[model samples]
Target: MIYINFNGSLHFKTDAIFTSQNRFAFGDGFIESFRVFNDKITFETLHENRIKASCEVLFLELEKFNLEEEVSKVLIANKLKNARVRIHFFRVGNGRYLPETNQCNFLVEAEDDNVQAFHLHTIETISLSKQYFKASHSLGNIKSSSALLFVLAAKEANKNTWNDAILLNENKAICEATSSNVFIRKSDGLLLTPPLNSGCVAGVMRQKVLQLLQQNSYQIYEQNFTVSELENAAEIFLTNATKGIQSVVKFNNKKLENNIAIELVSLLNKEIGL
Candidate 1:
């Protein structure tokens, strides 16, 4: 059974539902996705705060609805102990080029994702021939409804039988993966990820991992590095709220080590009390 909360109303998966064009496909909005583990929602408040911040950045006025409450209700109604949930928030009112009203609309969807343990899933990635998303774009950092660059990257990855694609910013600096933040463990034992200014989404798990590593006295830095630097990286890992940390075993044809990634995954699972 599947359940969706569309515009403050709940509907079963089989129910016929319709959303207006302005709110469905063409609108100013963003999405926040996280996992519910052991019947507890991970980083729930963090995701909510990010959502609110994104709305402010977009100048969107949201309609009446309690986001956390709605999410909880959906989980309870479906008896979901472990699930991956996505909340879509978009503008509701009219206009062709510009929306007459900026009131926001929300839709929530969840699927059972009973991941009881954290394991290192090594991924094979390929670097794109050209930069797709301009990290310097106005809405680049925000996970907006307009995700053409991400779509293109995914299509390219599928064509090449790759697990993910590496995206670069305007300056040809490493940015992030399509849906996950990229991290490179250096040969000298330092971890580096692109700074937020480099156009990477401020992911919930990324922040958590940063804090966890710092607490453990690990040397981690957020700075831009070139593709040449990546070629020499000792290890490459991806982080997201759902999968936690995934080690990139190979970037194109270069093999990467998983020693640090495995340790970090253990530390992270312990930090999250999973």
Candidate 2:
């Protein structure tokens, strides 16, 4: 279920509707995040930065949208305290391949999300599918609406009873999961995540985790790694804005140690004051 606010006014929609000729309906849309905390929105700057970057990549105008104000209005009108809100921007006008106007229309959707952080307790996540095409360098990092690949992977995960599936890159390097960034804690106690070149989304939580790790002098590296490295790791975890740090207790039949994940989750929650 979703509560929607279109533009500035309170609006309700039975489902997301777009014209047949709309670029967004044709898979050309973008999504941004706004996390609500204590009746106020947090990480406005980060969200704005990401949105601006996405617009630049997609050639959309950012000057016409007032996202910050729209988010505040939606939260207040809906009487929400803590939640995960998504602002979806899409081209509304018609065109064969390109929209007549790049002008974007947005719909703000909010859902109840618990405030407490969580860690994954399940062991042995399934491998959904082999890597397909590489996400283009110009468009890879931004969370644009180009979601067919992710949608299919997520569907497979749900169907297979897997918590999440690991995605590989065109080169067969471990990229990320369906909706979260991947991390591995080495036997010697170092952390590693896929580099931007690996086609993983530059997740806000992933960025925050890297910052916190560096601030605390923990050894961290960003590079392309393979599934073999994952099987050899002492610990595995996933991170996103919604879930913070979730330990992947097992991948297939292998059980992973949670010692580092536990320590990091505690430290990260404190660092972010969650």
Candidate 3:
């Protein structure tokens, strides 16, 4: 498949410019991955809104980026009827580690789909007390450019031969996965998820699961709970835009039965009309 990069009205073959040195630099706008199914993006509208809000929070002009159309064009040009797309937004500058707020660069990557089952490991993450006033926000909730923290953690898990890593907030509570939301089911049949303020991403599937739970009258609660609670949970599953919902069969030697997870999976697949 062919790939294209958008810089003003200029377009380039992705390899002509997408060198390691270029992508590794700091403050190159933001990058997000999307899965395309049957030629349509998964949660297309929400993904669009998310990038737009994130760009705004980053203080970059949306029109200047012209992201949605450019990425769409790349998809069409590549004839990617179904694939994975990585859209990156950047505010370029002259040789500074810190990028300028202006001179944005938008990149579109259409790659083959890679869907696989995932296993999770509970990992520790130090959550710095975020203060928004005198400092610029990095669009944590909105999803933004800074991903080294998650990237490093995921790599750690992989080095240990695990599929993915689960991160905990400073409070020692379950936060989220390196790229998804965490779900826990207690012995009493309570479907528990950490609150958004508990340092977890409000993932698209997470939201959809909550709504499906409510519609189906599942006992879903949003509150802060400890890692110990997860240890005792009857079933554990992770959700995201890509992997969808994956059952955590084990976490740090804690073995779990996938029965309840199977039931929920069946229900979710039907409820979401997947």
TM-score of 1: 0.92
For residues 1-274, write the lDDT of model 2, one tens digit per residue: 3457775666655754655666766666788765676755555666777787877777776445676678767767667777788888877677777567767678887777667443434435656355344563657787777777888887777777877788887788888887778889888888899998888888887887788788889999998877788888998888777666677767776788877668777776575466
lDDT (tens digit, per residue) of candidate 1 on 1-274: 7778877678896886754556556746898888887777787777877887888888887756676788877888788888888888887765666777777878888888768656677786656535375565546668877778887888888887887888988889998888889899889998899998898888888988898889989999999988988889999999888888889878868888988789887987676687
Model 3 score (lDDT): 0.64
Candidate 1 least-lDDT 10 residues: 129-138
Candidate 2 Cα deviation (angstroms), residue 3: 4.5
Best by TM-score: 1
lDDT of 2 at 231: 85
lDDT of 2 at 139: 70
lDDT by residue (1-58, candidate 3, tens digit) is: 3657566333546356554456336655676666676566666676777777666766
Question: Where does model 1 exceed 4 Å of error?
Answer: 63-65, 129-131
Candidates ranked, most accurate by lDDT first:
1, 2, 3
